[model samples]
Target: MPSDSALPQEDLAVRLRDGDADALAAVYERHSRLVHTLALRALGNHHDAEDVTQQVFVAAWRGRHNLDPGQGPLAAWLVGITRHAVADLLAQRARTVRNLHAVAAQPAEPATASLDGAVTDRVVVAHALASLGEPRATILKLAFAEEQTHEEIARRLDLPLGTVKSHIRRGLLQLRENIRGVRADAS
Candidate 1:
């Protein structure tokens, strides 16, 4: 009997349908390059293309019983599957972008939750600010609570202007993460 690679495409498709693992390997070796190339062309990123290539083969193996040799070439069916995989990846990327944008579009106020008569929200924000530690917590308090300018804070803290600015930046980020975590848990 011929090796899997030596068999005709239709015979390989049939063998693959019958659950022959060697046929799956043979199918991959013949078509992976084509799949990867198509994916790369559509995605324009080598890493994403490689991921889509792997997704195609995995999907192909999982759906092997669906192959119908009489309909067309196995290569063509693989091409169709590749197109679908690429579309799914692109859609996922779009959703991620939209989610990121939604997060960014939130109100610029430091804490919307603070505007209410809720001491709980104020306590949460204070706890988040305190958790920042040392110069960061102090820097944030001096900047926001005292309404001091960055230059004023630098002069008062005896730190470099840049160091004061760095502390404030990092402190705000950590506080945001902490507060967001609290909000998520509350909801």
Candidate 2:
């Protein structure tokens, strides 16, 4: 019997679509290097390319039921998924860069004459964040300071996706109320 690794790409695609996990593995073995190289070239970073390659395989496995053997080679489909993953990662990077630049370009003062106003606000916010305690504070820091997506935070913290999101929402509201208290105190 021919191993799946030796099967034709179309056969492998069919096998994968029919829920053969081994076929997915075979598909990875057959075209992984091609996927990695293309991702590396487009992303221009070996690490990111590797990440995208992994993402491509994972996505392929999950979306296998949609696989049509007639839609050209499986390699083409993998490449399409790779393109989307790379584009998404690139867009995220661009957004982060723009946000950092906007923050950097902001005037130092907090629209107040006092030199320490901005510092005070930062300290207050930091304290407020810290007051959330434990996982809530850590989650918010990961979400805002580190600019991690909820999925990333969920994976890193080993929390449920919905739980991570809830923490962020509640944390933000608490921070807002904290700031309101600060403003009232200052006045």
Candidate 3:
């Protein structure tokens, strides 16, 4: 049997079946930043995001036994957890808004500030990039952070030229979608 270090998460799950705190810690370390970013985007408040991040990991750890190796990478599972946690925060916020609006004498027009929620939007973008697995994540970071060309990315990752282009295109699309959603929610 290979050591946990030598095996993928599927095998790690087996080693953790009976209960290994280390496995849970490793998973948290690997994916927590991604989860935190997702939560921050959803909630738009750092304090709330931090609390929700803890909840997301707790849920994942408690449900670790149900993980399916064939389905996907553990990161995807964590992303799902992050999404749900954010949704929960959104729902709660909506409830509070509804309650507050009911008592307000005059509803202020929703602020149409030009720079509305830009910070939160950036945090969301940072989180989304962090969530992406390596090669994809590394490719994106290089493409965006350094304004590297597709050829440069290929050279850095030693991947095929086509693969580099595909990654950048796909990553940009995803980032656009994610940022749009975050902005919409923030407003």
Flag regions of model 1 displaced more than 4 Å.
Answer: 111-187
Candidate number with the higher lDDT (1 or 2):
1
* lDDT agreement of model 1 with the native: 0.87
* Candidate lDDT (C-alpha), each: 0.87, 0.86, 0.74
Clashing pairs in 3: none
Who is ahead in TM-score, 1 or 3? 1
- For candidate 3, which ten residues in a row score worst on lDDT? 113-122
Candidate with maximal lDDT: 1
Candidate 3 C-alpha lDDT tens digits along 100-153: 577475675467844646665567889888766677889998987899987788
Candidate 1: residue 110 lDDT (0-100) = 60
User: lDDT rank, highest first?
Assistant: 1, 2, 3
Candidate 3, 180: how far from true, in Å?
A: 42
State the RMSD for candidate 3.
Answer: 16.3
- The model with the greater lDDT, 2 or 3, is 2
